[model samples]
Target: MSDTAPKQRPQYRNISVPQILSYRLPLAAKASILHRVSGALLFLCLPLVILPLFALSVSSPESFASLRSYVDNPFCKLIVLALIWGYMHHFCAGIRYLCLDLQMGNDKHSAKKSATAVFAVSLVLTAIFGLKLFGVW
Candidate 1:
């Protein structure tokens, strides 16, 4: 007869580490955030925000002239210019994400490169559109 109970075994425990935030995240992550934000801006610019533009287009010469006088003001021009930037930025960011979906420029390095390119293109397009708007081009 054994003097004591059968031998006992030791238990082991599992451990996990918490995720930390850093300067680096994936390109897809950055692009995803930008896309949603830009979409929101573009959405808000619809309806009443675009009414001024419509008025300028369809009203008679005198009415159109009034609309122009208003928009041509520095403050009004600045606001419209910002809206133009929002539209172009959103559009370009959407395309950048599409390229990622196609598995193009998916690498970390190439992704950063394309992201910068997206903003540059957006800025250029916004400038050109603003010029066209005020008859500067």
Candidate 2:
């Protein structure tokens, strides 16, 4: 065989980055992402909001009364509602993850259904708890 110069492949410097808005991710991926977000929210809120309020509530009778009154604030109510949602979503998604880890819902259809169920259960539970929090029950 005659040795000649090897052909070099052309290197095109154009790199195309796909637009995020045009990318459609599956429901299960969305649920998984939300699970992480909810967990983070719960973890951050525990020390910043809940613990301080809990400590104040148990400090004395006056403090408890003050805390009770504080809960009546619309802003505080909204924060509590958000916290409730975080807890519910985290709890439901965690259960879903546990089931997944156990090899349940491993199939595509079952995985989608389980993700949907996690969303529904968490939202429904949050709604019920929200109603009670708002004194509608």
Candidate 3:
């Protein structure tokens, strides 16, 4: 037997911390995150924004007229436009998710395409309605 013991093998480990923010996320991941964000925004706005506006608009003829005029403000128009974007994005993304759950477009390339399509459809819809909202048409 040799005086020296057998040499021990060195152990290697993966210790690098990933830079999540700097990393480029896939389109599907980005859309999924935005979907949740838009949903939360709409949910939050429901109690604080839409209900009050609806109540005020239908409370009486005087209130209805005041509410209608209130919406004529540029600030109100912008707020409504934002809400429209939230709604359109949420709806389109929800459909995308439903299809994914059914196992359609579950592949990597298909998922990316679907995500791009979802974003395009949502933005196009928002643009169209936004034009109408701003009285461009």
Query: For this target, which candidate reaches the highest TM-score against the unseen true structure?
Result: 2
Clashes per candidate (backbone, < 3 Å)? 0, 0, 0
Could you estimate the TM-score for every candidate? 0.67, 0.84, 0.82
* Root-mean-square deviation of every model: 10.0, 6.8, 6.9
lDDT, model 2, position 20 = 53
Model 3, 55-85: lDDT tens per residue? Answer: 9988999999999889989899999999999
The number of residue pairs in model 2 that clash at the backbone is 0
The collision pairs in model 1 are none
- Give the per-residue lDDT digits (tens) of candidate 2, residues 1-137: 35696877966475456555556988899999999999999899899998999899999999999899989998999999999999999999999999999999999999999999999999999999999999997
Q: Candidate 1, after superposition: displacement of residue 91 in Å?
A: 1.3
Candidate 3 least-lDDT 10 residues = 12-21
Off by over 4 Å in 2: 1-18
Q: How accurate is candidate 1 locally (lDDT)?
A: 0.78
lDDT order of candidates, top first: 2, 3, 1
Instruction: Find the 10 residues in a row with the least total lDDT in model 1.
Output: 14-23
Instruction: List the candidates ranked by TM-score, beginning with the highest.
Output: 2, 3, 1
